[model samples]
Target: CSSCKESLEDQCSSINNEDNSTINNLKEKLSLISNFQEINLEKSLTLAAEVGTALLQENDELRQQLHLTKFEKSFSELELEDQLEESSKKIEKLINEAN
Candidate 1:
């Protein structure tokens, strides 16, 4: 009976050692996972900033194009009006000379 008791004590000690090893391995895996997450987070932030800057530059370019289009349209309208006014004056002079 004393020999059986000693064997059981040794088995318990072996089981404890295995358990401690498993716990340590799990802790190391958790630390690695945490570091990986931090690295990914920084990469995500950097990409987002780059995308935001690109979008802002595109918006500014579109705004400039719009302003140029508006100016060109205004200039065209003024030219058409001037041409029409000159034609009307010439027609009035012709009618007066005929009278």
Candidate 2:
């Protein structure tokens, strides 16, 4: 009877140890998952920020290009007007000389 009792006790202790080991492994896995989730969140935010910055820079470049185009168009119109005035003056002088 005493030997039987010892055998049962040993079995119970072994089962408890196995359960504890399983519980520890699950806890570690849970912690690792939580850390991974946090890291993923950080990476997502960083990527979003980088994309936003790139878009902003692109918009600024487009605005500058549009401004330069407008300036050039205005300059060309002014130059054409000046040339037209000079031609009109020349024609008037030629007619006066003929008369």
lDDT per residue for candidate 2 within 1-99, as digits (tens), equals 346446555655665565556556656655665676366676567655655665565566556556655765676688799999999999999999999
Native-to-model Cα distance after best TM-score fit, residue 30 in candidate 1, in Å = 29
- Model 2, CA-based lDDT: 0.64
RMSD (CA, Å), candidate 2 to true, equals 34.4
Candidate 1 deviates by what RMSD?
A: 34.0
**Model 1 quality (TM-score):** 0.56
- Model 2 weakest lDDT span, ten residues long: 1-10
Worst 10 residues of 1 by lDDT: 1-10
The lDDT for every candidate, in the order shown, is: 0.64, 0.64
